[model samples]
Target: MRTLPTPPLCGEPATVRIELYTADSLDACAYTCTGHVIHVTAVVARAGMDAHPVGMAPDVDRPCGYVHVFPTGTLADEPAELSHPRWCDRDECQRRDQHRSRARRVDTNRPEAFIVDVALVQALHPAAEPMVRLTSVQGGAAASLVLSVGQTRVLRYRLANLLDLAGARPNGGRWT
Candidate 1:
């Protein structure tokens, strides 16, 4: 099992709505916040699917960006990840498909490839407050999202559950 920093959260629901569908700035820059270098990757996701639900037994073979925080570092440190999971292999993709009935071609750069900071997201109490500072390195407009309390709770639950399954402690940092 591994350890992680406490996530930043509002602890309660917010009174207003905060929508992050658009980017704030178009500056091509990167910044470090809370000891971590926050930046966007080449990956881009759909409107609301940037962060999807995690399975109880997540595919360990999959890249979740967890490796980035470890002593060994992130997928950027592992060249092999760029090829493995055979994103373009139609056969492999069909075999792993949950529907199992469709043999569709694999698209690696899809929404699933992006990384979501589970702990950081889970700690957010949108009902208590809206607006989160988001930083992306990839060339794109900076964006922010305002989630409803219901949406916030659902995401928090799923992410927290994943952390619990991984034996990763949450809220062990200054934000707690």
Candidate 2:
């Protein structure tokens, strides 16, 4: 897993929220948070669906929603573990991973299926906080988004294409 760049401390505490979406819908099962650092948890795919509650499983009848984290600062060196089962026997999950792995190996040159881009959206007042948002790009377009940091903290961003990002590091040094 590749990490994102961290921001310098203004000596102020900030809160960030990351929302995941797929195709036309918001993936309610996925959740993210960014503050002094970024943390991505509950990444549940079909292969790993068995790990989550049946109510939280991605709707196979519909497009799947994937949880992604792109921090303005460097993320942990290792991929965060899913709270649920790590692997599933579902063909869809296997197929998705296979396709993503191949694309990463050939295109992005990363070992994983996704590459996140973290950008500095703003520097709020000492009393003000910031938020982050994540959304899926339609038609597989070049993913780009705006992160609104503050009250309401609505994240407005797109998902970049899947590519290899295993060895890549954030432009700036790691946060921790």
Candidate 3:
């Protein structure tokens, strides 16, 4: 039997453990369980543990690890999509997996950002400086600025300095 639970969202803390077992087939060996003359193929290698067939799912609703983890829905006896293969290496299933990848690629991509809806300044740690946390419209953290109370005045001065600079202009003047 295999079990794969949905992974937590980004930045959400979670701990997971997976067990690998090999069962014998009833036809070949006298066992009632449907195991194969073959055991589960070891795909990953860990330092202390034996090689195991385990991997993280790239995205939701997409298959990862074994082929049977997310099998194609069958109509009658054949594969559902004729163009795609019935096995684990099906192209149709692969297309469904197109999303943010867990593994790193050769090309570097920047982290996504959104419009900030809220800006909160709080001292998360008593001994530490204040933190200016920017929250996106979706409520996720867009960015954070750790600064002292004096640094906040500097920021305010910098913004006001821009207003002063713009005031020097004729059209975009003060109060207009």
Best by lDDT: 3
lDDT of 2 by residue, 1-176 (tens): 22222223334322332333333333333222233222332332322221222222243222122233433212223224322122222233221222111111112344444454443222222342333323333345546554455422322221111112344344555311
TM-score of each: 0.20, 0.16, 0.25
Best by TM-score: 3
Regions of candidate 1 where Cα sits further than 4 Å from its true position: 1-141, 170-176
* lDDT of candidates 1 onward, in order: 0.29, 0.30, 0.31
The sequence of per-residue lDDT tens digits that candidate 1 reaches over residues 1-176 is 11222222323321221111112322121111222222212121222212212222232232222212322221112323222222233233222321112223333344543332211122112233322222232345433454555677787799888877877753554111
Task: Give Cα distance to truth, residue 75, candidate 1, Å.
Answer: 53
For candidate 3, report its TM-score.
Answer: 0.25
Q: Worst 10-residue stretch by lDDT in candidate 1?
A: 13-22
Q: How close is candidate 2 to the true structure, as a TM-score?
A: 0.16
In candidate 2, residue 148 scores what lDDT? 53
Better of 1 and 3 by TM-score: 3
Candidate 1 local Cα displacement, residue 165, angstroms:
1.8
